[model samples]
Target: MNHELSLDLVQSSVLAGVLLILGEFARRRVGFLQRFSIPGPVIGGFLFALLLLVLRQADVATVEFDTTLQEPAMIAFFTTVGLTGSLSLVRKGGRLLIVYLLACWTLAVVQNLVGIGLAEVLGVNPLLGIMAGAVSLEGGHGAAAAFGPTAEAMGAEGATAVAVASATFGLVAGSVLGGPLAGWLMKRGKVRVPTLVTASTGSTTTVVDQGSDTGSDSGSDTGRGPETENAEESGSAGYRKLLSTGVLVGVIMVLGTLLGTWFSDTTGFVLPGYVGAMVVAVVFRNLNDRFGWVRLDSGTVDLISGLTLGFFLTMAMMSLKIWELYALALPLVVILAVQVLVLVVFVAFVVFRLLGGNYDAATMAAGMMGHGLGGTPNAMANMDAFNSRFGVRSERAFLVVPLAGAVLIDLVGLPWIVWCMNWVG
Candidate 1:
């Protein structure tokens, strides 16, 4: 008999940390992985998951993890994403964000249509097709899991299994595809990020080269190192900022809960749990930006957001149950192959053109592919990786991609899935 080892919440969190550390080491040494900018957590998480699968398969050991931290981590990470959106950034990226969001909704509609239409052609039940479509693909495991019971209730046998398997394929495929897609688009189009050029005619130009990771130079980098140093020296002030910002984030999350609950309860329009918190954070950020009510540093907020995102993804990926994917793999491959072809064409012809045929657009296209195929974390990893290697930080892509993929698409996508179910039923 195989030994069964079940970890509690604390142990699971620690394991996730270990996986991230190991993943980082692998990413540093792996040539192809480094060239593409694959995130450390993804590398580590997948490796750990595969290890679990292997152990279980061999009947040497079976491990169970308490995944209680996963959802809260996701919610917290997304809330930080909302914090990234100041009113100024919004004003600059508003049109692009809106357009990208609309494109996602359209894509969701198309995904369902393709899945359902092809399922009919193949003589599979259309209800089963819906599970394979946006539910599993664009929505990932969470959405698939959410819709699974409903589909089963509607008479689709083994709906949950099908959804989980399809989503697993999508997660891996999306991760592999995103970095390559963006790289290809940028290379083929000969797109390059615009470099800042100043006409230095006897004018003192202070050049501080901040590394590629943080995008543009901050105030400290612009010959203001003294001010930055002074700020750093003020230990009390730094502590106050940290405490205040932490408290504010907590307050915003609480407010978001109340607002999200009210929005869902009062109106029939249900939203994902994190959306409300994120929207509230956005409001707070914009308010702070405009009125200077509280000094919220963009750099600080970004640091916190990055931390949350890393931990969230680490915990989430470490809990992957891979063995369950094998049984439903065959049918999904054909269905998903068709889905991928559509994504390629759609991204090349439609998404690229409409968003703009520039480097930022290419990065955004890659991000869209990530979220469209996998989920939000995949999208972020793709964009982050592309940006890390190439220094193409499209603020518009960062703001729009997560909100659309994580929250906005779900609004219409879920309804559309159910409608397809009702139509077929």
Candidate 2:
């Protein structure tokens, strides 16, 4: 009458790969999904989850997976993120960049506060609120996958499910919010696009290039453009770089996991293994930047990140227990609703004004809604839509938003979330 199927680590990993490919295939075929920038893994994995739900309701069978590799995959991805934190590049972004970075940091804090406050009012674990907050909103699926287990380890049931669900909501909400907001601002005829004027040597004036998305030196930093590619044979060179980057990530992950374990054991802290790996990566990146100690290529690192993140997210999504979210459904909806409302208001009033209230500011506001609720890719999509309609580009927005959203914002945001998780637990 009842049956169960359990998979070993290798089998589970192989299944995850299949699901990831399935998702990608679906995304390529589905027009609506492509429009909203919904991730492929979510589509494929969620469909599987739905099938399992139906099977369980029919009393058919249950399936289980061994996810021993999930944590390492997560750690490797975060380590790639760590490698991207270049303070020298931050300085190159100048004052406006600093302001945008600060705004991102503030948004992360506020997201957590709003989530925690709402959760307490609704009578759920505040840790779940943290998951719905920065863990998913700004951190995206990767963070949800990384921290969900930690929240569960601290006794918050269904935290991962809540986080993943919240992130899915955000991805859609962000995609929709950005275009309308920017369109309204543009139609109002109040904000005007202006050229940037830079003065060097107190006499020489240079006009910043308003064409390229990544700007000059930033191409390498954000892993954009072929210029960042290492010199070697075209096809084989890429494979070599990817392999080298994987090796580097592995070394850092091992060191970070050991460090996290030691720190947790010695000090009774709740430091996650990925956090340790990220920290080591940040240090190594900064030192390498100053000393040129290693042959680090951002393009290769980005590739590694993409591969690991896809696999981790697919694994996380497939493992989700939809039934666990049943009791928390109403509270989850309320929290997400408030989050969307707060984000729109904050971008309209605070972020727009703080960014100087020009056409560039409006474009940046769209990006804020994108990554503020979703991830950097969502932000880029929002900006792309806005630019395509307006017939202009906000090079400053493109430069600052992605640079900060993708890498620098996490420098402060991750530590803050870690602290909040500990305090609440």
Candidate 3:
């Protein structure tokens, strides 16, 4: 075989390409996967992993870890995630955001502690357990790659291998545990779904129609109302203003990061560049809302989030080493089982109660399942499932869960993982 077209390289690349295409198709076409819940990227990644594993076991394909490709892809994904800190959404989320952050932080602490304890009992270095548990499982692949190297340098022999195993198990366990918890909660709580008509009726009645009398006076005026005309104009103008504000916000975030870095150096207090940018964005968003500087742009926020996650997932999936996972199977399974149990109990009792317990126990359960296990995508999937059968008030769940998963948990988890490493190592 020619060097460039060697069987191993060509086969691996082709397999990855095929999986990506098929994953996208499955995401669009498969209703059950989308609705009842499983992250599309994870589903795709796992299937690819399985295929590679089969090939390797059969002696048909070989994979060599290229540290070069792994690090850059992982870093790029993390940087993109950093860039997605939308000021407007952070402002809008408000106290709920704070709550979500706290929850994430708390969960990270619990997860790491559990891992360390388990590691001690199992007789491996607790650092190995921590890396394989929360850092990989909750934080996903990028984190696994980040800390896996550190773990190896510190003498955990199979750090990356353990991290991958933990992450794969986390993805699976998170998906499985979230839905059933949601279902059980809904059944137990007997929460009734609120009607959209009923919720809107009260708000709608408060707006007095000045054209009500005019409609009665002439049939010609019956087809349209002043309120409707004003609404259409306002909606268009609001959207335009939101777009303008979003662009300005992005610019401000960049500038703020530069300023923050300067201040950090002079004042001896340094913030992570991305964290500084997020804080600035949050301030800008709140200022815009408070003084009416700009209307919030929902579309732009959605677009940024979607693009960031897509690229991140793509990079993450490509870097996975399915072959490395075969070495650490026993401990990975134990860690995953414990983590799942913790998530199920915590979400069912604690998260649901904290979120005001008004939602169908099922929907809340699904949200917890997603956030606690897999992250926001998993939670969204669970909510989609509940929405299909129970109706879609799950929006509240969606809003809160992602807020917790993306920003809050990461900020909190990094420190906890570091602490665990210190204590255990």
lDDT of each: 0.74, 0.89, 0.62
For candidate 3, the per-residue lDDT at 220 reads: 47
Give me the runs in candidate 1 sitting further than 4 Å from their true place: 86-90, 94-105, 112-236, 259-270, 287-291, 352-425
Q: What is candidate 3's lDDT per residue for 231-311, written digit by digit as tens? A: 989989877765674566457556556755886688654443434554555556556566876555556555554544444
Clashing pairs in 3: 182-362, 186-361, 186-362, 370-379
Clashing pairs in 1: none
Candidate 1 lDDT, tens digit per residue, 209-321?
Answer: 65655753455546665547687778677677777777777777778778867976886455445667777777776787778887776566666666666666666566656
TM-score of 1: 0.66
Error of 2 at 11 (Å): 1.7
Q: After superposing candidate 3 on the true structure, give the runs of residues whose Cα lies further than 4 Å from its correct spot.
A: 1-19, 29-49, 65-70, 86-91, 190-192, 195-323, 360-362, 422-425
TM-score, prediction 3? 0.66
Window of ten residues with lowest summed lDDT in model 3: 1-10
Q: Candidate 2 clashing pairs?
A: none
Residue-level lDDT of model 2, residues 1-425, one tens digit each, is 65898999999999899999999999989998887778888887777887877778788988899999888889999999999998887899987799889999998999999999999999999999999999999988789878998999999999999999999999999999998997776666487655556677657778977667566555566666544354434767778887887898999999989989999899887889899999999999999888987899878998888889899989999988888999999999999999999999888888888888888888988999999999888999899889877678889989999999999999999989998998899
TM-score for candidate 2, residues paired by index:
0.89
